[model samples]
Target: MVLIKDVGSEKDKKLSVSEYIKLLNNSLSNLYGEVIGEISEITISAKGHVYFVLKDKITGYVLPCTIWETNYLLNGIDMEIGMEILIKGRPEFYGPFGKLSFITKNVELVGDGALKKAYEKLKEKLEKEGLFDNSRKKTLPLFPKKIAVITSNYGAVIHDFTNNLRKSGFQIKILDCRVEGSESGPELALSVRALRGEDIDLLVIIRGGGSIQSLAGFNNEALVREIANFPTPVIIGVGHHEDVTLASLVADASESTPSLTAELIGRSWEKAEQSVDNIQRKIFSHYEYSLERSSKILRLTFEKAKKSFDKILKIHDNTKQSLRHGMQKIKEKIKETQNGVSDKKIYITQQFQKSIDEVNNKCLFNIPKFILKKYTKIIKDKQDSLKTLKKLIETNNPERQLELGY
Candidate 1:
């Protein structure tokens, strides 16, 4: 499907100057590496491209290097003579000028002293510009549900972040890109820009810990500016605890590790969950107390009604004994009076029997019915109150609201 050109096969082949230069550049492309040296001379074109001469610190050998304006600005390093630096790129030959130049893709300060100086300089400048001001920082949402993550897809950083995150029904979108090396700065910036206008609640950029040199991409001026100006709140978790990148400084929030970043994002949700649990417990406790109190009231009411019923039954029995004694005395009187008092005695007996029947029906049927009706109404009222309370709890339940698509 493809042909491989074996340019080295014909060592004796004649070629034009341009052709030879092209082949030379092709060969030089494969010779890319990082070169550390001291900057001997530096200049900037009107178009912002950088031209510098790097001399080997040990051998005194000098090599010319050029970096495009975009790449130069992204590194955000100030070039000066006598400063040690590292450049990563390949050599290119200019046919017209008959010159060989190292085209740099990335540049970094070499020594700790140089790196610290550059870092402080940029940090001071950006700080003075109010880039790191707390007032300028946006607040992360209290309960962020939609998150956009920018990180390299290759390493354990992503896995660490995901594993540390709680299962809070978050919507995560990941943008995989290079997180190290010369090309990483532009790639990160581009990734941030690409996420603009996305339907996300928060933007997170994370990576594992590394030295200042290895984490240079996060110090990129362009990436820092992009993060500062991002529409959504930006969170950066990169480098070690002691190494704070410029991009992290400008972000809305910053953390030392990817796991910490995930924790920060889930904090509000976790708190909310705890709060809900507490409320639910309180509600259940209150409901139980209410139920127990209602039960006690019902028991007290039943005892009081039972005592009243027993007193009424005793009075009915005493009244019946008095009537029976009076009827016996009247009967004895009637027999002594004979024929004249027969009708009177019969009437008296009928009246006494009717009164006994009324007392029996009232005590055995009406009294019990009244007590049962009153207790039944009390029970119904208690049940209705419990139903209302249950409804109120359900209406205010956050989980129930979510289930109903709130």
Candidate 2:
């Protein structure tokens, strides 16, 4: 005989195995779980419980399941031995058989192509949102202050981008992510958000060389949306010569390989440097012109000794000082033309350098002004020749000269 020490509190009561399973199903249904899985079998039992097995591709997980519905799946739909289905189902465990089950209610047929389906759906959504519009495209900055790279850590993609960028003298911030498999979307989105606070002028979303399936995470809708809304411009470097994904379409620029993207950016920087070289030359030449012009004006004042000579010299001095100050302003303006710009400034002054040469030639103090006097005489001789020709044509025609001389 057993003596009962009655612990009568309801809190002491333990749940039965069946009750625990029922509670688990309730919790799972509350969570609203769904998966895209491949079905291995479908058959009708005499008891009318439909049994099947669902397995994942990469993981190869097989779950034996039963659906308790009279007509949930249509009869004569002919589900074969190997068919993939998107199962909207709740987990169940039968106490009698001691077997696990997924009692699916709403099943959609998508064949055995998870990647293809995901690609099509993502492409459709992105296209409809106008993420791929040409109007939204931004020209890349030639000399970006900093660039953000998002890719898997310690991979060929990240390695190539960082090394090349450092060699090219660009600052880089890398946002590491899982570039493949199931957790890819969340990781890609995290990388995109990381760029928001990094103060990057541009972003590079990159992946190593791999199959189309390996890069599927970059094609995820959430990541693509984050990219489309990213404040900084993005460059997609997926590294495939063929088979561009939807992410490429939505990005600001796309390159086939990581190395190619780096090369393109480096070329743009070179062009900006070339422009700076050109502007520097022009600015120095401009300053030289100003100095020459000022010296010429100063020397001109020393020449004439006549009435109001000092007064006129004072006027010329003031004018020369004012023009010198004006030249300084122009020189400063020309120096600022090196900043990166879409279109080159088209208003260059013609003969600007030649004018400086003329000023420099005219300002000589040690050399005699004999060359100037000689050039003046030559101009007078040309004028006299023109007058002689006109007067001779007016009176002494060749025929009239023949009669007079004869």
Candidate 3:
């Protein structure tokens, strides 16, 4: 049993061993920070938890540290007996073992050389697993309308990205988080997982430029795998031109700057607009050409039609003049025939009258009465035949037929 002051009860209380350890652990949680030293001894349990001893080289001081399997694996560093490392965590007393241990939540290599060695080692391992293969990468949507962004809210990274993004017609969902430091890796992984069931077209993780150490969170093994296997296509734009993080390598698309990422998202839309403009111009040009050609064809057709009409009218006038001339000649011929018939009738009457007077004188003086009677009868019959001939001529005349409206 142990006697301790209980803050909740505001009194001194007797606590069992388990309760005492719990209270100590609760207090130790507040003493969390980073610790750096050389690794002296390392062990891995069956459950994959890492137990390591860190020693200060100059002072020869040592501290025992333990990291859970999840955090150990996420840091992407294979512990060796003599390598230097930095662990960020708090001290906790293990009730079963009766030992105080530094519980590491995160771990990283200590120096630039060590970090580079670890980075290269992890890069080789992931490359062998085909996580960096182009075939495994997803394609960015041609027209992404909804985007989920994971980045630090307390910096210019988000602002640069948003400012460069297109102004309208995009639904951006941002998860504000730390982009550096020990907590950033897990937070980024969680942020990605949080958007698992979300309705988004794309995922973007970005951060401003940083040193290799500051960008170590982007190289987290868990975060790399998360981006590599993400359901939606992912784009990572972290660090400067000189930096390329593991997260960027495994992502479907990578950019050197957050502004560049925004440009890539809006590139397709810009191209589509240009294509539309080109098509519009083509359509207008085609229409103008067709209209001009049709106008020319219409003009030629109208000219042909007018010439044809004029020719027909001229031929019609010529036919009318010929018909008029022919009708006048026919009328003159009919009038001349009528005049000749009248003259012939007059001459025949005069000759017949003379013949009758001569007959009367010769026959009456020298012939008997019977002979005179026979001559009179013959002359009267001749006169009657002459009158019948004149009547037949009058009935068959063209002038008389015309007068009867034939």
- Extract clashing residue pairs from model 1: none
Q: Model 2's lDDT to the true fold?
A: 0.66
Model 2 misplaced stretches (Cα beyond 4 Å): 1-121, 138-142, 166-170, 181-183, 266-268, 284-406
Estimate the TM-score for candidate 2.
0.47
Best by TM-score: 3
Highest-lDDT candidate: 3
Best-first order by TM-score: 3, 1, 2
Superior by TM-score: candidate 1 or candidate 2: 1
> lDDT of all the models against the reference?
0.83, 0.66, 0.87
For residues 41-71, write the lDDT of model 1, one tens digit per residue: 9999999999999998888999999999988
Which pairs clash in model 2?
Answer: none
TM per prediction: 0.73, 0.47, 0.83
Q: Which should have the higher lDDT, number 1 or number 2?
A: 1
Residue 214 CA displacement from its true place in model 3, Å: 2.9
**Is 1 or 3 the stronger prediction by lDDT?**
3
